[model samples]
Target chain A: MPLEDQLLVERSKKGDREAFEHLVQLYEQKVYTIAYRLMGNHADAADLAQDAFIKIYQALPNFRGDSSFSTWIYHITVNVCRDELRKRQRRPTVSLDDNNSDGNNYTYEIRSTAPGPEEMLDRSETQVMIQQCLDSLNDDYRTILIMREIQELAYEEIAEILGCSLGTVKSRLSRARQALKEKISKQMEPLSPCKRLAK
Target chain B: MRCQDVMELLSPYLDGALATEEREAVRLHVARCPKCSAELEELRACIGMLKELPLIAPPTGFRVGLMEKIDQLPSQQGSSKDKNIFDRVTGIARSSWYRVVAVAAVMAMAVGITSLWEKEGVQFLPLEQKPKGVVAVHEPQKASKEPPVVKEQQPSQVGQSSEPGASGSKSAVNSKGSGVKQPDPQQGNATVPVITEAVKKQVEGYVPKPSTGMAVVSASLRLDVVDIEAALKSVGSIALDNGGTYLGSQDSGSIGIKVPRQSFERVIGALQKLGGVLSYLPTEKDVSVQHQTAKAELERLKAEQGELQTKLTSEPSQELERQLADLNQALLKQIDTMKQLEDRTNHCLINITLQ
Candidate 1:
């Protein structure tokens, strides 16, 4: 941990809100990115990222710093996503037409300085295509892929986070990569078969 | 190897994680086979595309909303047992109904001091057991049943959190995941966390002790209450009085509270009397075997790791390296499981549905 981060963590443990908010400002981007990648939607990404931070705040006292604080927070972000994903699996599927039943029933407040233009710029053809492919994947494949590929977590760390053995992580990550490749191919083949399959 | 065999190793092969022979075999196979080569290429492209996903900002008001949510959270640090007991006594001392008792206790303290000093040889004490003053013994109900004995000198402020088990192990810490100081009486004089026999007996039936397999007990109740809100408040208060936390309504709208294991039945009985009991189910789970197994595994792995460290000093081989890495991962997994087990075995969760 950086000296500043170490100091911030100590102060946060002592219930210093300013120190905690500063800590949040420092990692909000990384934590939000992890949430966005796992959740694949802005609304859920926002909700769950905040949930992750709350969990981080509550679990801060118990943090023995066994792992790097980055790794610790990343693990929390992933776990929050995993739990929500699992709960969604168990939840009854709601129809798209059911407005009230939709998860994001609350109206999004218009920000004076919304990132509409920046988000528009970010949504190039390739980003959307790949995200669509990622969203098409099963929960396990998507989660493992995000952790390994996007978060770039080590296989040992992924294994520890998912509470699986090393062998399981390797095989599952390999399968996830294969699954993602097939999804990407399926998505790309629709746009231009010649370009996709070209040598 | 066949295409299936080659495909299974391609991701790790891309990341340079395969064994040397497997890497070489996959490389040679992909070079020769168009199908395997295309699959490998596609996997590489997919990873590249994933990496291209831009870092997007969170929705507006993310920080403001998060801070607001955090403000509602119970203060974990301030809720230490000492502060809570002090606050409780202070709250009670301020109440009008308790003035007579308070005044009487003040008078009694003035009168008991010389006798108490002579009998107990200057307890060097400010006042209470578990709490920290004369106010604790003023509980007229408890004072009559059990004669007051001076509390043992406290260890450190950090040494106190929850009730200790028979062994005073870290596992004996509360399920709240608070700071658990593993007090060793065998250590120097200052570190003695001596919970006197009398003190242990006082809280024996009420508090959770994380020992004897840490048996967690809980109860679920379905009640026909006249008003849901009142029932919820009553249930929450019951939890508070028993030194537990109310978990509030889950998505299913069931009111939940987590109390100490020993207090599970008492809480259940009290709740049952509140209204017409539609259904009640008490559950108990003993996790001693699981706890013991994880502990043994941790010990064994640590010993093996020590041996490997000694070997690494003499010869640093890849095989030894792999063994050490695997052992560390195993240790991490074991530690996570142990933590979950301790958390579960620490408290009993009661979910009550009001009809």
Candidate 2:
């Protein structure tokens, strides 16, 4: 945990509102991205992340210094996102937009001409589809991929976050890498480089 | 350089998570084998692409919004240290400082109130003059420690109201409970109405008709269907066809629905369309007896509140004023719970599971 987070945690234990708020500020993006990877869309991810934060806040007073705050927060977020995924599985699949086959259509593009934001909505949307492809993966595969690639957590740290043996973490990551490779390869076939290379 | 050996090293090499010795071994092996090199490159690209997966930055002010929400939560000071109410009370019991402060506060209030009363020549308040109504119907229900459990069950029961006028205090949530569980509208569609009507008929003769222009109904059912989705659509169409809508649903595949009391049979006929019926859960939950008791208690509280308020104005002692404030708070909490229960019971919550 960062010094700021440690400071916030101490203050929060003493019931300081500002300190808790600062903690939420520091972690919202990281938590949100974890939820986004698992749930696959902006709306569901946002909802899951918010719920996890609420649980984290509620559970803050119970902090026992057993784990780093980041690890604890990650555990809470993954658990929350998992619960959300289960709930979603039970319900009928309803997309907010039906014209697009992919649920990743919910991703908005900032459409700019230069590197600063010039990408077309199509490019942004394709990026969203790639994310959706990532989301369609199984829980074990998705979490390993996200932790290894996006969050860049080491194998040992991931094991701690997931509460699994390091061997299991490594095995899951190997499988996740293979699965993602196959998916991206398949998805990239339509693009120019991949198509030309294939030919 | 067998496939198995290459495979063993692939994960770490692909991740750049390998040690120097392992990295050198894999590098030499891949360099010597075209297939292994191609595989490594592909793995690297795949991992790189996954890393590049467009991270949707959460909406700006996410932290601000989250912090605002955190600030809004009632401080968890009481529950954090103590697991439950018993633990909390025990902690208070064990604390000498808490005991001393509590006793001192009570003594100070008593002396201050007495001196003020003596100075003003105030008379004692008589309880008989308090007005009795729904406000009075609220306390025993509130004090029963029943609200949280009832609130928890409300989502499960909201589809079929077993108790008529049982107000479901669950606000209209787009998702299910306060947990991360999204409110499954599809589940609500399938089970809400069949259970609602069953509860209505159950309460028809057993419960007293509310004198306050309200009705109570209760029913129990076991809906056996092969597919939960098809059942929900069929039941939803039934409610829609009969001019009703779904209220809620349970994980067991039971649904709660609300239809006009007059079209009860139509809703029942619609539910029967939901495929083969197994044994329906019995809605013998007779709130009538409990309802009467709660109504009486609520009336009594209202009367008490009125008496306290009147005494506060007339006698104006600090103790009386504090007591009046306490009574009002209790009364409000009770009313809120009753109103919630009333909403839930108004609709029938049907519990069902498909084999």
Candidate 3:
């Protein structure tokens, strides 16, 4: 833990609301992003992120610094998302329509050197397609994929968060990537034969 | 490497998670094999697309909204230490042993106190000790055989006091002594002392000694407010300003407030100013006896716990250690009850209903 975060956790454990708010500000975006990718919607993601922070605040006192603060937070976020997904499964409410009509407005801004307009448009469409495919996977596979590929967490960290062994993490990540690849490939099958063959 | 082995290692190869030897094997095989190369390239593109997915910025004012929700959480749940205490206290209070013991003890105490007051002809005074105007309603037909003690106390005109207007003092005494049956000590000389001693022992066994006098002040107020939510917020603020807490609100537009005992009246007054007072009922319950009883029990249990601790240190027996553990648990429960009672007495509860 960074000295600043360690101090904040200690103060938060002591019931300092300000300290907790500071901690929330520090990690809210990261936590929200992970939740968004896992949940695939802004509303559920935001709600889950807030819920996770509240849970993290409640569970902070039992935090013994066995893992980094970020790892602990990621663990809590994953659990919150999993629980919400479980609840949705049981209740089976009619989810809102995909509402991807505005998909064109969302462009993937890659960190590499800026691409041309045509390249950017293709990348944006590919990003949205990948997200849709990712959302279609089972909770276990999607969660592992997001934690590894998007959050960029280490295998050890993922294992700790998932409460599995390092070997399990490796196997799960491999399976998750394979599952995602199969989904994307199945979606691309309907496209032109030339595009498919080029790959 | 064969196609199957190459395919199995491709995912890890893309992640750079494979061992160096495995990575080399997959690399060399994919370089020469078009089929395996296509598979690896496809997996790489999928992962790259995932990694390049746009980061969604949280809704605006998320931090503020989260902080507000955190503030709304019960104070006890915000800290693990407080949550532990709350959980343990609720657990003990809900446990069968505690429930049975507490109910039995309270019943026994009530019975003992009633019997004591009857036998000793003790007048139980209200906690406030205020004297009210007496109303005498005559019902001569209901009078039983008057005890000799009563007659002896007013011997001047025993028969002459039969007149309704003249018998005020006698009637008052009769009314006060209505429920008690005075056993004739002379009729059973040998049984009297034994019965009295048995009753005394039973009463003493159940009721712990009372300690300091502490009063719990509670008030209920109904207000006709133009704005219910604003009135509720004002009531909450009043409690906070008076070094207290806004416990919660019910669906019936009633809010529960807790303020320091010393500021109970002040909080009530402030609440009254919030809107037109429709109804206000303020009461004081002297829980001194109950508080003291729990405290005494806690002390006794703690003393026993200390002795058990000493015994364990000297002569370690599994049976003794088990007994010690049970005693310690009981001690913690008693202490929790004492603390709860003390808190209740120190802070007053005010239920405010907004119309």
Candidate 4:
């Protein structure tokens, strides 16, 4: 643990609400980002992030410092997300976006003048397709991929968060990347004609 | 390297998790094999696209919303520790042996209090009266033989002031030196003051400080009521009558009520009158320590905020501005928390469950 975090944890354990609130401020964005990727939606991600912090506050006293505070927090976040997923499975709601075959309409302003509108659209479409593919994977694979590729967490950190060995983390990442590749490739197969014409 | 070998190492190589030798082997093979090289390129493109996915910003007011939720939650110290003690007491109550021990302990306490009250003629005053003083009966010869349990009760006595007379008296000597000497144990007489008048005179030279600790009282009740709505209404009225308000109510026949700490026992008594209580658990948590800790923290933050403000005024840098902003936020949160603790300690919560 960093000396600052250790001090914060000590102060938090001693019922210093400000110390815990500081810890919350420090990790809220990162936690929200991970939750958004895992949950594939903004509202649920925010809910999960709030819940995770509340749980962290309650459980901080018992935090034995066996693992780094970040890892401990990530572990709690993943568990909370998993519990939410399980609950969601019991009473499923149809997502309106699921039927909307049109890609995300949210515009991305390209900073560079190199790419034309058509190329930007294609890239945006591909990005949407990749998200869809990531959503298609099961929670374990998707979580590992998000932690690794997007969040850029180390393998050892991923393993600690996932409660798996380093070898499992490696294999899972490899499998997740392969699965993503397959999905993207399948989505792009129809675009090959458009690609050839664009070329 | 075989094509299959190079293929298995591709992901790790892309991830930079492979050793130098393994990375070199895959590199050399991919350079020689077009199929392996294409696969590696595809893998790299997939990862690159994944990385390019824009980071999602959490909705605005995320921290504010979270802080609100945290504020609504029961403050941390009282709930868990009290729950553990409550659970242990309940557990021990369930076992026969422990129940016997508990009964014995209660009996011993009753006897000790009764004997002391008889000797001192100490009247139990209403909640408003300041504990005048406890008549400390110390026998010099029997001091060494005093039970450790009696010693334990002295601090509680000291914490709660008691006076020497039936009528309220203002004399410090009457309150402080009320300890009477017992000549014989056979007569069951009151004992002498532990400290002699000379010693008390010497001690009187020092200033006396008052106790400022606050106690938080909480109760949880499971009731079998005739009508849930009626019971809830009665509970709400009870709270209102006691200068409290209905904090909230749930559709599931659960209601949260907050009443003044002084009227906590009265509120519980009123609640019991509404229905047959299946379980009534009242706990008093001394959050003086927690309150003091938060006060100290608030003072420290306020000092820091003042220092930061001074620094910002002297050097108008962006870094100082940001730091000041963060410090202000932290200070606000700390003050809010301290205010909440004070409010919570002043009012007791009664979580009533009706069936």
Chain B TM-score by candidate, in order shown: 0.39, 0.36, 0.41, 0.38
- The clash count for each model shown is 2, 58, 0, 5
Better DockQ candidate (1, 2)? 1
Reported per model, the fraction of native interface contacts reproduced equals 0.51, 0.43, 0.49, 0.38
Off by over 4 Å in 1: A90-123, A194-199, B79-355
lDDT of 3 by residue, B51-78 (tens): 7776656665677778878755543231
Candidate 3 chain B lDDT trough over 10 residues, lowest sum: B130-139
Task: Please give, for residues A49-164, the per-residue lDDT of candidate 1 as tens digits.
Answer: 99999999989989988898889999999999889989888322212122221243433322233347766544455666677677777889888998888788998999999999
Residue-level lDDT tens digits of model 2 in A141-178: 88778777877778888887778998888788888878
What is the lDDT, from 0 to 100, of the residue B2 in candidate 4? 95
Show pairs that collide, candidate 1: B127-B133, B128-B133
Residue A18 deviation, candidate 4, in Å? 3.9
In angstroms, the error of model 4 at B237 is 52
lDDT of 1 by residue, B315-341 (tens): 544476456655655654566577667
Candidates arranged by lDDT, highest first? 3, 1, 4, 2
> What's the chain B TM-score of candidate 4?
0.38
Each prediction's RMSD over C-alphas, in Å, is 28.8, 24.6, 27.1, 25.8
Report every candidate's CA lDDT: 0.68, 0.60, 0.69, 0.67
lDDT of candidate 4 at residue B108, scale 0 to 100: 52
